[model samples]
Each structure stands twice: as C-alpha cells, then as structure tokens.
Target: MRNSTIDLLKVLASQIIVIHHLLLYTPMSPVLQAEWPALLGLIADEGRYMVQIFLVIGGFLAAQSLLGLLGKARDVAVWPLFKKRYLRLAKPFWVAIAVAVLLGWLSSKIAMHSEISDLPTLAQLLAHVFLLHDIVGVEALSAGVWYVAIDLQLYAVLVLIAWASQKTGQLKFLEPAHALLLLASAMALASLWMWNRNAEHDEWAWYFFGAYGLGVVAHWAQRESKIVLSSLLIACVLGIAMWIEWRERLLLTGVTALLLMNSAQIERFVTLIVQGPVRWLGDISYSVFLIHYGVLVFASSVVIALGLTSVAEMLLAFVATWVVSVAAGWVLHRVVDR
Candidate 1:
C-alpha cells in the first residue's frame, strides 16, 4: 500500500510547483499580478522550495525500497536497478518532451514567447534521452526535467553505496546495513557542510544529498535501537550546519526529515485531511509534474492570441489552465505511466 503521508506531500508539492510555473511563464500572470501582486509574489518566491519535500521523500522512499529498514542489500544488481529507474523516469519523460515540443511549435505559430523552447537539435534530444542534458550542458525541453535527471543520479549513488557496503561486509563489528547507514550519514554531512553551500553544485546530486541522506537516515533510524540518539544527532548536525550558514531550503529539508522520522503521526494526520481526490492526485503526481508545463504554455499562448487582458478573463484563463493541466496529467498517467 502507498504511504498516505508521502502521497499527501506529493500532492501538495506537485500543485504548488504547477502554480509556481504558471505564475512564472504565463502572460495571464501579469494581469493577475496587477490585481494581487502579493499573492503572486509569495508563490513565485516560496513555491520553489517545495522541491525540498520531494528530495527528502525521494531519499526516504529509495532507502525503504532498496535497503529496507534493516538495510539489507538483498540484490545489489546495480545495473538492473539503474535500468529500471531510468526506464521508469524516461518513458513518461519522452512522452512529455513530445507534448512540450508540439505545444511549443503550435504556440510559436500564435505568439512567440521565451517560455517555449526552440526546436531541439539531435544532440540535445539524445542528451535528454540519456538523462544527461544537465551534465552535458544542454537546455531542457520541459520545465523541471532537471529534477528527473538528478533523481536518477541520486538513485545510482545510493545503489553504489549499497553495493560497496556489501563488498566490505566481512568486518566483524559492523554489518552491511549498519555500514550503509554510516556511509550515507558521512555523505550527508559532507553535503550539508560543503557541497550544498555552493550554488554552482546545484545541478548535481551531491548538492542535494544532504536532504536525501537525511531521508535515508530517518528510515533506518526507525529500525535502530538508538532511535532517539540518532534523531538527536541528526538535529544537532543540521543545527550546526544552519548555524554556520543559513539556508531556507536546508531548513525545510531538516523539518521534512524530522516529520518523516515520525511518519506514523504524519500518516495519521494526513488520513484526517486527505480524501479520495488528494490520494488520486498524489498517485498521478509524477504525470502532473511532467505534463503541466506543456499544458500551461499552450493555455497561455491561447490567452495571448485572444488578447485576454481583463481581470475576470485572466482569472478564468488561469483556472482553466490549472484544470486542464490536471486533466492532461490524468490522461498521461492512464496512457503512459500506468
């Protein structure tokens, strides 16, 4: 069964990201901005932070799936894991890229805008196909595609770490699982202290490993006998990291990790708040994230073509875009992701 709390976070973050992109890329936003600058500004400024929720949760779920609470490296067939993850992310991603390209071409015929990508070259297309667009310095065809690439990289890193732990498991004092946790914790500290502090590293998984590693640690902590100590150590390390240099994203990651450590409470809380629609949205969140940008670009282009400027007209257009994005996401989930 799916964890309801993780699903809740996914639903909320995915919607916020969709709205954030809408406000960022849509011409209708300027009209709404005139009417409600504060609201628009708030979403534009803070909504990006929702990514931290996904980073933490990705780490949590990856750890749970790959290592389990016991940290057992049952089948560290790294190549198979990597192939499965890449295919899972890339299949829907390729479809979304097609959607983005088609809508971008159509939108250009109506009204040219910077949000629409230029026609991709063969090299750029290949880069995206291999999830190497960021590493190879090619611009993405769709918004938020970088996260998909980074997610794959992070999983590879985790799998490699698990494999290494298995190879070194002959030590009498430390089992492979314990060693895996220690290695992950060490990497997390390095990320939190060094790599994450630099903006230049943002394109890579190492920069985000602190948050991801926190999720891994939180998962293992639940099964450890020294859960309280583990939790305290995590908080103390994060506290020191913040004390050295304050980052709101890191703070959010820390909070997410702490909540995930007590996920039973969170699951209970979300059960009270999450209904059928929310659960459904959460199930299709990946589809929504992939397809919404294309839908938004198309909707905005139509609004621009119609010269929609009135506040009511703009508001209606924005609502229609959101609804259409959700509907498109549902279709993509059914046809591609399912």
Candidate 2:
C-alpha cells in the first residue's frame, strides 16, 4: 500500500532541505557573503517550513500505519514492535552519522568554526549522539536530525494509541477518528500554552502533531467516501495561502488527505510519474536527509582543494554528496537494516 503520492511528497521535501542547506553556503563566494549574505540567507530561512512539512507527513503516516497494526495485533507487546521500528531506523541513521564524521574530518581546513573539529567536544559529540543538539542547546549538529526526533516522538504516541485501541475492542470503545481528534486537540492546546509562556523550544510541535492526526483522519476518511479531487484542491489553496507560516503549510496535509482517501485510485497515475530514478531516490531518501549536510562539508573542502571557485562548483558538491549518500545507504541496507 505504498502511495506513490506519499513517495513523491517525500522526495520533494528532501529536495527542499537540500535547497535550504545550499543557501547556507551561498556566501562562501566571499563576495556574496560580504555584499549580500543577508539576501542569500533568505531562501534557507524558509527551511523551517520545509522541515515542518516533513515532520507532519512523517507523523501522519507513522500514526496511521502503527494504529492499523495495533488494531490487528491485539497485544501490548511493545518489544517486538519497537524492534521492527528500531532496525528500520537505526541502521541508516548510524551510517549517516559516520559519514558526517568523516566529512567533518576531511573538510576541517575550510569548515565553519563549529565544524572544524577532528574530535568534536563532549557536548558537541553528545548532541549529535542523541540527536538533541538543538534541543539541549547544542547547535553544531547537522540539520536532518530534527525530523528523526519528531518521528521518534510521534512513534511513541502512535504505539500508545494502538494499545488503547486494542484494549477497547478495536474501535468499539473509541474509534480511530475520535482518537486522532483528541490527540490533535491536546497538541493544539499545548502549542497555545507554549506560545503564551514564551517557551523557546521546538515551536513546531503543533504542526507536526496536527499533521499526524490528519493522517489518521485521512485513513478513516477513505472508508466513508471518496474525496480525492476535492481534497487536492483544498490542500493546494491552503498550502498557498499559508506559504509564509509554519502553522499554515497544510498544503501537503491536504494532499496526504486526498491520497489516503483514494490511495488505490491514485496509484496507477502516481506510479507512472514516480517511476525510474524517482522511485530510486525515495529508496535512498532517508540517507539523503540524514547525511547530505555532512557530505556537503567534505565536498566543500574538495572543491577548495581543486581551486574551484564558482557557484557551479558548489552545485557539483551537491552531486558528490548524493554519490556518498547513495553508497552509504546501500551499505546500511545490507548490513544494518537487515
């Protein structure tokens, strides 16, 4: 039940991340960093919204999938469930961390002060080790770790709901839609409180939780009726209007709703467009998201070594990064993921 639309959305979101990282180095041109670094920084500034989209989609799918499983399993056995998820995630994760380290080492000569470490300090290393660098006040880690954290949090929520669903007679006590609404409502209230309290941490929780809940609602929507065309139109309109705010990037949310409503119906056309390398990118996309920044670090150094000094060279660095990321994914799939 792989929806090509979801796969397509995943691939596109990964590219948005790439664009954000690319904006960071736009000032490496020396001239640009001096003359218009502020302007160059704008594109990447939107990276926050881009990351939000990823979080929402990941949250949405994780909840929908796990809840469905829980309804079927009818047990509170968390270990086996945890194991399956752990294997699927950690293998590719560790490989990416290793790659990030190597990149840090190779690019030491020209890296930003924070990244120029043969052995990153205790705090720095631990931040990355736990993917809590940004959370716990260490900003030296790469950008991709945030989504992993969000996914982990949502997974915890999903597992609990699944267990509850089973105990309650699998929708007899409280259906999935009611569960999603309750969760979404709780998250929204928490978000409001956080905003009022001047909390300075992880302001994107509402979007992530809402998206995950939407995903759950979408799953149920398909059973009631078909609404793909209507869902797409609304998602597009809302996504466009809220283009400026993280709270408003519900565009993909709508898309996710439509696809879930018509998962099988859309599969045929989606498969045609999503074929070839597009499908392949989705395979390695997890790796790309995890390690692209670190790969770019080494790539910057290599270009500096060859005395290449053009925007085009920077573009080539992106290519080099994908090569390493793709290879890293291959190794992880074989050794760690298995």
**1-338, model 2: which lDDT tens digit per residue?**
67677777677777667656755642343433344567546645665556545654665576666656654654656667766665566557766777777778767766454444465678777666655655666655565676776566566666665665555555377664455445654553343334313435452344355556556555545644536544654465445435534443455455555565676677898899899888877766676777677766676666666766666665565555656755665465556554
Worst 10 residues of 2 by lDDT: 190-199
Best by TM-score: 1
lDDT of 1 by residue, 1-338 (tens): 55777888899899999999999999988888889999888998889999889999998888887676235446688899899999999999999998998999999998877787888999999999999999889988999999999999998999888887776766666777877788999999999998999989888999989989999998887656456787798889999899889987887888888777777656777787778899899989999999999998888789988988899999999999999999999999999999
Listing every candidate in turn, what is its Cα RMSD in Å to the true structure after a full C-alpha superposition?
Answer: 1.6, 4.8
**Full-model lDDT for every candidate:** 0.87, 0.59
Scored by Cα lDDT, where does model 1 land? Answer: 0.87
Clashing pairs in 2: none
What TM value does model 2 have? 0.76
Regions more than 4 Å wrong, model 2: 26-43, 109-118, 122-127, 170-199, 203-207, 223-248, 311-319, 322-335
When summed lDDT is taken over every stretch of 10 residues in candidate 1, the lowest stretch is 66-75
Q: TM-score, each model?
A: 0.96, 0.76
